[model samples]
Target: MKKMLVLMLTLTMVLAISACGGKAKESTTESTQQPTTKTEEAAATEEEFLPEPGAKLVVWSSGTEKVLVDEAAKAFKEKYGIDVEFQEVGPDKSIERMTTDGPAGVGADVFLAVHDRIGSAVQSGIILPNDYHEEETKANNSDKAIEALTIDNILYGYPNSVETTAVFYNKDLVPEAPKTWDDVIKFAKTFNDPKKQKYAYMWENGNGYWNFGFLGGYGAYVFGKDGSDPSDIGLNNEGGVEAMKFYQSLKNTVLPLKTADITSDIKKSLFTEGKLAMNVSGPWDTISLKEAVKNLGVMEYPTLPNGQPMKPFSGVKAFLVNANTKYPNAAKLFANLITSEEFQIKDFELLGNLPSNKKAAENDKIKNDPFASVFLKQFENSVPMPKIQQMNAFWSVHEATFTSIWNDGVDPKVALDDMVKKMQDSIASSK
Candidate 1:
């Protein structure tokens, strides 16, 4: 199965550390020598880290971020005398698409992806570890970002940004953001109107991404040991069942609607129209929400019913080097260069993303911006989504399990236990 999957994902990956490597190592010899030739100078600087001579690389970038990639490509070409081609591929779809494209030799040499999907990329054997720049990467970026991109101890990503959801409320309806889930519940008493399609609070109900906060606050995790142990599932544990019970209870009292009826579009429309009082959304919604509502406020999420800090999953976006690339050295260099402090800041300025670079995160613009500030604070308590292949299956199971409990009256424990079993079955079958 492993071999078949690799064949499905990529044809061959030749990344010889001896052939094309990383930074110049610290020389211990006392004698000093001068490099005479251009090749010698390049080797002495990178020492073994030089890119393949005349190497050109292809980079897969999202259409929205193509300009940034173009900038990086231009800078790289000027510095190394190698050209780079920019190809449009949605960052979210890079991993799956590479599975077929990579083997055919048309895939990117470098690509951008969210940290959560690193495991699938690794298991498919289509990407190279960030072996060349690991040390400096850790020193320059946030530890959590580094941790998120590492799968089973291998550094697979060059960190770019940190993202997580936070509280967004209408200042007219909510004088102050709710400090607890109970606070949201209390406000619902006077605010809910089933016929008018108005509600005090609303979120994507069945979506595991948002709902995971409750499970986390109640002390349940998806898989044990930071998602490395597939055998130790935690969704059916005591905390998980309790979390779902509270999640189930909120159905009628707070929202007064079925999970399917509360789509994100409807919620956004209601919030903008001044009907919905509050919402749990990410930073991406900042501009749109601000345009519609005069008094929109953003803040860290309120504590859960159990009094635990909201643990929404923090997602780190990263640049990954493809293993199938002909020029591993050039690919790694390009990946590292694009995620440097300069580019990170540019990404923030142009895209409104929160940079993973420590210095970039400390910039006054991000610190002073209310919406960006909230997500940065919330990231302190947030957990990265599991970096395991099972997560690909876990999302569907989570949605199914939560939907059944919220809509069908299924018992939380029974539903969760079934969820665990389904996860195990899926993991086993995938193997």
Candidate 2:
């Protein structure tokens, strides 16, 4: 009976040991398998957001921009192991090409545009609003540059360069930059001799783009304050008529040169030859002015007689992404890369472009450039060009008003009132 009891106890102990071994093996297997599942999930989440490794991106560029764009493309491809192809298209012609190609899915993934064309592009639905790096881009770029590119309070593109007209003077001719319109008039009385083709200042005064500063300085505008409303035109307001009268007085009293006689080429030649003391021009004239004149200097537009600064129309150059791009994420990444601080600085170095990136504009090279620095100062008081579609009609009306006042010697108020009526009719017809 004792042997039977002892054998029963040993069998029970062996069964308990077997159960303990099975539990240990199960725990070991679960611990090993759990981490593998979690690791796979983490990797997949990372891969989901990353751009495809071998995607190809197409870019549209102008011949003048080829060098900078090519360098940027090579750098982008090296970083992402993607391929980039560039098509040489002029900046002015890009909008038309995109309009035809975007809907067909044959347009470039990215292209450059002027800010004034944003309204038209948005209306046409060719360009897409930037969705990536919004905060980073706004924080790094100039406020005005960003504001110029925004339509209906939404940013449309990445601003790369900023340009506006400033007063370029000959240091030897003027001795000092004029501080006010009155000073310019005072000097012009003695300096200007139309018979000799010598003048204190010369500009395309009949063109709306160049003459907008005069009207705008007196509170005239093509559209409403935000530039989004087309019905509210301010170009023929009380201040506008008064501003026109002032402009006519200058042409009649101080400057005898007519708009037809003083073309852009003539103005450039006069300034380069030291026949003109001061001229209103933008950064595009920098290279030629530097080579042609020995004592070239730049200053902000002279203040008007009514204690207002001459607020020239400003334009920003930006890159827009095509709405029909197959690789939206990759296209956005490339846009950000091209507008980066490094690339902006390189563009300034190579092309003499005024960078819209605040950090890039602050570089020692830009800071030391006399011409560039004056433009930066003038930008403070400059107004952005209207982005409304009605601006197309406003140009012709503006030229007529200027011609009637400056060329035909018509009364300023009468001409402005007629211009307003014609402009309203044009706008109504377009709609």
Candidate 3:
């Protein structure tokens, strides 16, 4: 822990030195301004936050909606005269790359990452806080987006979209979404035909993210209620073990393939072809699934066997400025711009993503959107993926553990205990 703190301090010093010139440049812009009215004062204020001289920026995002970035970049150039480039980078990999590529000055000026990874980014000191636009961001975006992007009291990301898993079903086959996992199982008994590549339900069954949907109760969680207490892992608790047993029971009754055979692509292909009835998926797949299947319907997660709403992981994808960027001001400007209500609306119109901005969510199109609305409802019951660096271990440990329990028929209690121990050790080593 001390070594981590030292690294954070060292990186902070480097960013501080690099950004010190920004205020001087702002002051230089301010001195030349002779403002006599509030309008001019506002204009000066906007102009005063200037980027470094001749600074250009590259932004990294998943590229599903590159057009959104392109539009934002166009407006950004109009305002700051800075050239902004959009680069394709998966949010998951982008979070990892910031650890190595960012400090080396080879990463994008601003990059998109899932909010859960904020802990790693902040602790590494490779990303700057959303200091300049924190107030605006908070007032515009949903509370969940704000909370997910914040650590301690500091906001670290410009909120873009919020997502959670939900059960998507073929309306033609099922008519209504399953009300509970039991409903899913009952339907599976009659609907499943492995020989015909058909099933009543499908999902990334063995994946930790999917299994996380089953864990919900007063005392069952990855770490603790807020997922912040590393010492109090609850994955081995009574509720968690029960959830795991039901999880395995579902697999035993429905799908006959090994865990590895249930790839996302295969599930998707089956679902689209009407070979599968219901599957748990997020909004990213909504568009293509709707396009491929005319009767596609999405609804918030069904109630679990434990009589609680399925608590899948909730994720917020937001943009963060690279602390090591040559153009901190420009990078921040782009992040702020793209996270605005209009930009978020564009994201929704183009990609069907749930806008984090409150006004964007209130847009007529989004409010009426069938698919987006269900995920929004699910977000209420969803678990906010922990924003601690130790969550990395949770993923590594549980991914294999869940698969082992499901595929190898390992005892749920024993598997969970071993998984918790491994996760604890990984977190301790990192500390």
Candidate 4:
């Protein structure tokens, strides 16, 4: 009986050992297989994930257009989860700040200002090219703006607002609008009461801005037909001289105003009081004139004395992204949204400025607006202001040179010769 009990015990011990072995093997297998499943899950998670939120962007805008810029930025933040820190700086300070602070990472991630500053901004190596504007987006953009931003086929910014010249007249003084420049001249002559008040037409006699539209209408241009080529300055050309002569003819017919003499306040005071028949100014002048005069009328620039339509130099205001921005994608997203139609029209309504987006201009809200449509149509006949750095130097000297010629009896040819020489010299010196 003792031997039989011993054999049963041995068999039970062996079965227990086998069961323990099988359980150990299963434990080992699970440890190895669990990690594989986790690895697959981690890869899938990465693939399915969306970009992280809570990105922030810093921006700066030229002052006084705050109403327009602010609303647009607000819309951008709402559409995309972003925080925009915006500052309003003077128009002249925008480039200075960017050039000094952008590369250091202390400046704006995006900059909203004029396109004329692009040449200097690009050369500074801080403002980046917007190489990805979709074909549809390009289709609706201002061609002049596109040209301004494009440097050797690379575009630097998308245009938002276009500043162009239009005729603003006192409805009380000129019951009928003039259709041609000759009519305007005739009208000015008839209305000449300079002894009592300033005569008919007035514009800042400083920058070539006052000349661009008139000269353009007469088949003359600052830089010939191809605007980018500076070598073909039409200053001495026959068409150009004729345009200058026409301007000179107006010398005795109207009250002369220099850039320094005619401040914004002074211009508005004269025009609103029905002291002047017509004046050339930009969209920025609209609000003040509307406030100053109860009845203000705006129209396309009248035809040139040569009977050609007046084509003004279009000025585009755009936002440029900082190449050094840590959040480039976010900055680009904000830029794209601001230029979108929905946001643009809202900007127009709230700010009383024209929108560059074609679809936005066509919206019922914008199309039906009597004031908006009138200025918007002027885009059809505008060209972008020069994007060269020399343009700044040119603007600085313009008032002195033009005033001397227009009012002080300085020879127009001599003034133009000196002007062209200085402009070319300025461009060379900048390089």
Measured against the true structure, the TM-scores of the candidates, in listed sequence, are: 0.85, 0.82, 0.89, 0.80
The lDDT leader among the candidates is 3
Measured by TM-score, the strongest candidate is: 3
Local distance difference test, per candidate? 0.85, 0.84, 0.86, 0.72
State which candidate, 1 or 3, has the greater lDDT: 3
On lDDT, who's better, 1 or 2?
Answer: 1
- Stretches of candidate 1 off by over 4 Å are 1-56, 81-85
Residue 320, model 1: Cα distance from true site in angstroms: 0.7
What range of 10 consecutive residues in model 3 has the weakest lDDT sum?
Answer: 211-220
State residue 250's C-alpha deviation in candidate 4, in Å. 1.4
Model 3 lDDT per residue over 119-233, tens place: 9899999999999878778989889889999998999999999998888889999987788778877888899898898998878877887778877632478867787888888
lDDT of 1 at 251: 88
Per-candidate clash tally: 0, 0, 0, 1
lDDT of 2 by residue, 1-431 (tens): 99999999999999999999999999999877654675685556534655555678888978778888999999988878878888998666787799989999999999988888788788899888876667778989998888888877788898878888998899999998989988999999889887888999888988888988988899988788866678888877888888888998888656687778878788898998888999888886787788898998888988888999888888888989998888877888888889999999888777777899998999999988998998888877778888776776776577777877899999987987788788889989988
Q: Write the per-residue lDDT of candidate 1 for residues 1-431, one digit (tens) a residue.
A: 99898875554343344333332332423123667686676567665687899899998878878888989999999989889998888778999998888878889999988888888899899899998788879989999999999877889999988889887899999998888888888899989987887889888888889998888888889879476677888988999899999989998789767788878898889999989998878876787788899999987777887778878877988989888899999999988899999998888777767889999888888778888888888998887898888888787687788889999979999999998898888889989
What RMSD value applies to candidate 4? 11.3
